[model samples]
Structures are given as structure tokens and as C-alpha cells.
Target: MRTTFLVIVLLLMRNDAWSFVVYDDSKIWNQDSITFYFLDGTSQQKNEVKRFSQLWQRYTGIKFNFTNKKPSFFNFKKFYKISFKGKNNESTNGAINGLIQFGNLSDNIIFRKTTILHEFGHMLGLAHEHQRQDRPNYLDNKQLVTACMKNQQQSRAWCNENLFKKFYKKVFIQSEYDPNSIMHYDISNITSKDSETNSNIPESLNNSLSFTDKFYIAMLYNPKLDKKTLKKMHKQDIREQQQFEAKANAE
Candidate 1:
């Protein structure tokens, strides 16, 4: 989510981690240990990734195994997957087998840990809190579109879908609208404000998870909760959500 490599040169805004979590149980990694195979990166860079990514492990009780195995067609699905040489930092959300394009960390020491942890949140399947449907309309649609098109060379539709898409919270949302969520982007610089008195800036360049982040991750990966318990919890989430929506419609 954090893109140290791209932030300085490309002016691309990166999303941080934590906050409004994607309550899709299928995306949750049920395994105790997740494997990562890096296709590119030096010892120091790889070590930095390992060291910083451990932050997620500490809270979730999930373990990461690192490797440099040359991926073959036969072994493509083995790793959780990562690449550190890309211009942007990105990752597969949640328990599925996917690649995390972790941006290079050779230069930006300041944002390195933040970038790792943020993308790892995506790797754990947490969506951007800024995009939550429950959030107020903050980003200027016209201004944001112009910026993305001019600066990032992205298309109008791509900008809208990726930058301004609203995620309806009909699914399981274990947390609230945390502006400080790591999965949020600092949009003050990217887009114009809706009102002069208001700004969409986060309180800080968050480097750690919020309390709700730790709580929900702990719940998802709790050692005591077997698969059955997790299933039941997800079912309960759905039932409550339906009741809440129905009550709202009635009102």
C-alpha cells in the first residue's frame, strides 16, 4: 500500500494499512504460516521487507516464511508471492494465492516500514478505509480525475474505479471508518478539498495498526478459534447485517 519507490518520483498516492477490514472469510488466510517467494531484491532490501513485515505477524499470530525460489509454471502457486522491484507497492488481498508487488526500498528509509506493513494489510485482505461506502464524500471527483490523468497517466475510468470507488459495507466489516487506518491515502496533496474549512488529510503518516486493526486480526487468526468458530462468526455477521439493513429500510 505504501509506495516509497513510487511516491518520490511518480507522485503516486499510496494507501496505508488497517482500519475498515474486508470481512470476507474466504479471503482470510486460515493457515498459521504464509510463504513468500521474492523474484527480485538484494539481501538488505529483502531483509528490510522481512523485518518490517513482521509487524503484521506480531499482531495476527501469523508467521511468514521467506524464499527466493525461481518460480516455474509448476510451482507458481506455492508462495503468497512478492516482487520488490516495481514502481508501486501492491499485494494480493487475503488468504488467496497471489503476488505482492512490493516497491523498492533502497532509498526511502522513512516510508519503508510503513509501505511494508500497509501492503501486508492488503496481503491480509484489508480494504482501504478511505473507500468505504460509509465514509462521507471527501475527494473532489473532477479535481482527482484531472490529477490522476495528468500526473499518473491513468485513464479517467481507471482513476474513478481505483481512486474513487466506494465499497458498499453489505459484507462483514469488523471495524469502523478510521481515517487513521493504514489502508488510507493522504489525499490532501492529490485532490482539491470539497470545502475551504475541511481537509481530508490524516492525522499522521501512520506507521502502525489502530486498536481495531489488532482486535479484528486477532479475532480472525486467533489460535483458539477453530475453522468452525470462524464460520459461525462470519454467519453471525451476515445475519446482523441483514437485520440492520432491514431495520433501516423500514424506518
Candidate 2:
């Protein structure tokens, strides 16, 4: 059973690594900039988070201000605090009174960047792309649920309840589904058995925001930008991103 459990963990870590789920009462930040305080993390870790979070600010009008000192009063209800307290990576789905946990990605620079980007996606009021109600056609629910339930790391009941609340729960906020969105989980082989199509789940994980991600974020934060201009800008961003990737690969 130990080997079986280990295999499950490896599959989960390599395949469909999870993200933070939003609370029922979570709300988007109505203001332009968000201020964050680190409850626990090294200077390097906080710096990496700040750097990655700036990507969102570049696209949307949202800004992240990281502070070393805590607020004078004990009112997390109005503040955003991050820490490495939880066993899993997660953050509140808005500016609610919640904590963002770093989990196991504390030392991994690449993964730390990815996880921070993902959690910040939540902090900006985005839900998991895979959890969109329209995702059933692309995923195998039974296989995914079974995998989560059988994992020995968490209780079966907790797994079932949490998976349902996270993945199965539907949010009508997004109109279209984006598999390559930074908000999506890396699911490779967890599709439904009856899926007639290949699903074509991306083998490579999303390290940066997709064009669609940028467009929607702009839509949410800066709605004044016309759709036509956003699309043209998205195309330009995509070209620049591809060039950057090519140059990085050649290095």
C-alpha cells in the first residue's frame, strides 16, 4: 500500500496538481491595487512572488504592493496575508480574509513562479479553468474523482468533498474555456473514459499567461479597452512571447 500511495502522489504531482479553491463568499477586489504582507517566507521567496505577480499588473490595471510590516490592528478581514502554513498550495479567490500558502514549492524557483502566478490568479478573482462547468466534455470526471479518493495522503471523505467543491463546482463568470490558461491545472491523463475525442491535453505546463488570459484579465480590470484593440494587442503579445521563448531556447 505504501508503494501504491507513493505512485498516487507521484501521479498527482506530475499530472493534475491542484490549486486553491475559492470560498463561497469570496469577492473580487473593487480597488485598483492590492496590498500584501508576508507572514512567513524568506526575502528571496517574497521577491520571487512580487516579481511574478507584476505580470498580472502589466496586463490588468491591478497592482500588488508587498509590505514587510503587518497592519496595526488584527483585522485580516480587510488585508491580504500570505504564508507557508498549509500542506497544499492555495490562496483566497479574492481580497477576502484568507491566507495564501506556499506549500512544497518554497525552494523550487520555476515551480514557485508557476504556483505564485496560479495563486495570484485566484487572488484576482479567477477560478480554475478546468473547474468551469463546460469542462466535462474535455475531462473524465470518474477517473479524476477516483484518483483523488484513493490517495492515502488525504481522507476519502475529505477528498471527495473537496474535489467536488473545487473541480465539480461551476462558476458562470467565464464565458469560454481556456485549457492553456494559467488558472488551469496540469491534467494529462485524467480525462473521462467515454471521451470520444483526444482531448489533446497539453503535455507542457503553462509557465506564463496565455493570450486569452491576458485578454480576459484586461476585460475584467480594464473594461474600457475595446475588444478589437485587445485582440490585436493579444496577437502582438503572442508574437513577442514566441520570440522570447525561441531566444531563451537558443541560449
Whole-model lDDT per candidate: 0.63, 0.63
* Cα deviation of 106, candidate 1, in Å: 7.8
Error of 1 at 62 (Å): 1.1
TM values, all candidates = 0.69, 0.69
Tens-digit lDDT track for model 2 on 1-251?
A: 32343244334442322332222223556566677889988887788888878878877676677888886685534568888666888887765766788866744455566689888888877777776544645354544555554442555565444443436443323345666788876554223334323344445347678777877666556666677887787687667657755765576
Report RMSD (Å) for each prediction in the order shown.
14.7, 12.2
Q: Least lDDT summed over 10 consecutive residues: which range in candidate 2?
A: 16-25
Native-to-model Cα distance after best TM-score fit, residue 192 in candidate 1, in Å: 9.5
lDDT of 1 by residue, 32-96 (tens): 67888888877987897898777578666768889898545675333577787666677877777
In terms of lDDT, model 1 sits at 0.63
Off by over 4 Å in 2: 1-26, 74-77, 106-108, 148-174, 189-205, 226-251
The residue pairs in collision within model 1 are: 16-182, 16-183, 17-182, 17-183, 27-95, 94-125
Ten-residue stretch with the least lDDT total in model 1:
1-10
Error of 2 at 77 (Å): 8.8
